[model samples]
Target: MTATSISPKSSPDRLSLSELEAYIRTIDTSEYTKTRNYIGGSTQLSEYISRGMISLPRIRELVLEKNSFSASFKFLNELAWREYWQLTWTAIGDDIFDYIRPIKDTVRPAMPEAVINAHTGIVALDAGIRQLQTTGFIDNHMRMWLAGLVCQVAKCDWKVGAAWMHSYLIDGDYASNHLSWQWVAGSYTGKPYLPQQDNINTYTESLQKDTYLDQGYGEIASMEIPEILLETVDVLPAHEATLPEDTVTLDGLNELKNADTILLYSPWTLDPLWRKQDKAIRVLLIDPDVFSNGRFSQQVIDSIVWFAGQVADLKIICEPVKNLEVLTAAIIRKSYPGITTWPGIVDEPEMLFPEVPVAFYPSFSSYWKQIKKYSMTDQQSLF
Candidate 1:
């Protein structure tokens, strides 16, 4: 395939670390993840930071001296989440494998062929799946749909779905992918997150075909998505906000904007792009690369890369699991420096970003109880 065929239709402007580091300093904490996803990746920014495109200590100092507590602490919270998961892995040691298996193997399979063929008649999903197979990205909302289908409708094992998703998603990571799959399958937090067929139809608005409706894909009932049990909202303490000494907010948004303004993930989310600050540049973020031999269609991967690249100029797009705490801290510190990064804010920081409110649902308490009991008693172990 031509290079264009495998990439997003548009090209994103390359970013530098100084640009992103600057962007991180000024952005609202609640918008961190969303904005990061929009900006895309920071490999380039990482390179600059490593090469002294900007000084870390300088940025840290600037945050402190200005008493820009919100920005400083928010950025720190983002960093902290990343650290937490990393530590969780170390603490659990071999237990992670044990915990993951039950979560992966518990579900039952209901619609194997429909899932495989992308014939479910839900347009956005079919498109998303095709994109997954072709390129590897299915936006956050679409990801929930696919995961829900694997858990509730297909009733397949979470491992199978995760494996399928991982094989293609460019952004896939073990912690986020596995935990997310488990959460949907009732293994993580313990409640299954099954979307009603109608929900899919409504959300995607692509099921005009009567075949799916007649086959009962449309009338299915909804399963409640579970809630997470957090210890305290303060995942990180304010004392940890270590801003480099020289970090400075840019005078204006430009390619010359400070090194901290780099985009970490998707760029489309930046209102300026939508407003046509750089229409051609923004258009380039759409991946022209369209096909691949993988299970996901090329479109998905390209879109993800495109979005990530475009936004990378402003943030750091990392494996959600890798930098979760840092991202979380960044948001918390950015939103409320005085709140004390506790469980309340850490878990539901969504409240800070009104655009992305906390999406509440049922908990997996019952499921975990049953599964744990079965695992200890009658359940057959599988390799």
Candidate 2:
């Protein structure tokens, strides 16, 4: 789910808390339970939530201020699914990138050339690929269809397609993106997700029929990879996206001698309002290790820069974790995916439900059952 095109109520390139706040006030989540499965039916908040622009807690605080808990239950559950992946990542670091809880018939798959070229015989899938490449977004259902086409049909390792998709996503979070691919491939959830052509047409409103996917569940489940999808090309993750040294505008970073405190930001933790009142050196620190198994698109990096600009005097530091240096002055960062162990005060990421699973659970249904117990109350939303 390291995720849009609804763009909410403002420009996707630039958004503020005030703008997002206004958007949730009027958003109708009551219909989300029924429509979110459609290509354009989602509320379009994944990009915002993944990048720390907004959080589950903040969303609940805002949405509940206007809408009832029942009205937003389905919406909240969707958000919980995102959190579930993240929590799983926290429990088992880096391992989420691999195929786990396997079903059967997994292979070391590569990117199908037809998929990369957006020439897949499936009209909806081809368009989804183009949209993902061009705009850095595709609906979750579209994403599922694409994942199924690649993993189940092509029978490649889920990591290959997962890494490819993460590299281009504006909201790519490794935990969500990789684990989700495994879910579709049946390695994570123990059941392959084979979305038939009829399902795709119904959700995306595309009418083309007689494609390879145009078959019943039983027939499609047993079908082999179509000839069109047999040709594949290995996709290496773009070497950790970086801004050129000449383009790096920040200076005086190698030595932070005079700095009292450094408030850090990462690709995963770009909360503009975090520590806003504190008089500290705001830093958007790019630690390469933060990109687990895959990297963010350049557009995503640009979004990071834009959000940093919102914070007063925030500077950029592009260094791998191993080569990083922050001597003398104290440093602090939000406890994010990769920057968790950095030598400084690291704050735990804010959570909607602070009650995390004591033991790892392979499925969301299991994880949610444990978390559902620690609700604000049974009658209230556990957001």
Q: All candidates' lDDT scores?
A: 0.39, 0.74
Candidate 1 per-residue lDDT over residues 212-315, each given as its tens digit:
32235334333221211111121111111111122233332232222222222121122122222422212111211212234343433433444433332233
Colliding pairs, model 2: 2-171, 109-156, 109-157
How many pairs of residues collide in each model? Answer: 128, 3
TM-score of 2: 0.90
- The estimated TM-scores of all candidates read 0.41, 0.90
